[model samples]
Target: MYFWFLLIVKSVFHHITPVPKIALPTAQGFSFIALTDILYFKADNNEALVYYLKPYDTKTHSAVIFKRLSDIEAALHYNGFLRIRRNYLINTYNIKQVNNRAIVMANDETLYPSRDRGKVVEAYLKEHFYI
Candidate 1:
């Protein structure tokens, strides 16, 4: 009976999808953020600024990570994150509005689409709407 119980517990745990997380260096030490907490990423000079949803409010808190935006973008590609512009990567699940030239996030932050990637952005918007 114990062997059967252990096997059942293991099987249940194995079928659960693990939460996605990223480790980022902070002033104190490091911060681990679940992907669901991420709101967007903005390109700084040589790093990426990560914006995360704050509890009990519509605002976001930010942290600077010493990683390239492209690198972060690739890491988050499979997690509903989309590179909407040359300098911005947004969480599609957090999008509140889509406009001709910009997207508004749940926190009311507006980010413009890349001029060079206009067609791609349009296609993405259409696909998202259709689903």
Candidate 2:
């Protein structure tokens, strides 16, 4: 019952509320990153490597966020992120190209999806990349 209630609340609030910026703790302080600026997240065991466009800067930067990929995905999936692989959670807007076995990101990083997710990736490519 609690799970269902939480799901309902999330669904209802997800549409009405603006997506929140993810807070990343650093040695100096905390950094709040806008979801739109994020490119992708690479899972590394218990933490994730976040690649994002720096504000007012053309270069992309990376930070190690102390959260599991699944946790990050849970917070971001509703806001244009896709779990293409077990190790990669990508922002759909930053996808440059999608091949049969690999995806090229905006910053030229290539990632591979699991074979089980091939159909979903292909569908996304067909719907968005192809005419």
lDDT of 1 by residue, 38-69 (tens): 88999997898999985576668999998899
lDDT of each: 0.84, 0.85
**lDDT score, candidate 1, position 111:** 88
Candidate 2 regions with alpha-carbon error over 4 angstroms: 1-20, 125-131
Q: TM-score each candidate.
A: 0.78, 0.75
Query: Candidate 1: lDDT of 64?
Result: 92
lDDT of 2 by residue, 1-131 (tens): 99999999999998888756888899999999988889999999999999999778879898999999999889877677888888988998888876667888888888888889877877776776672
Candidate topping lDDT = 2
Return model 2's CA RMSD, one decimal. Answer: 9.0
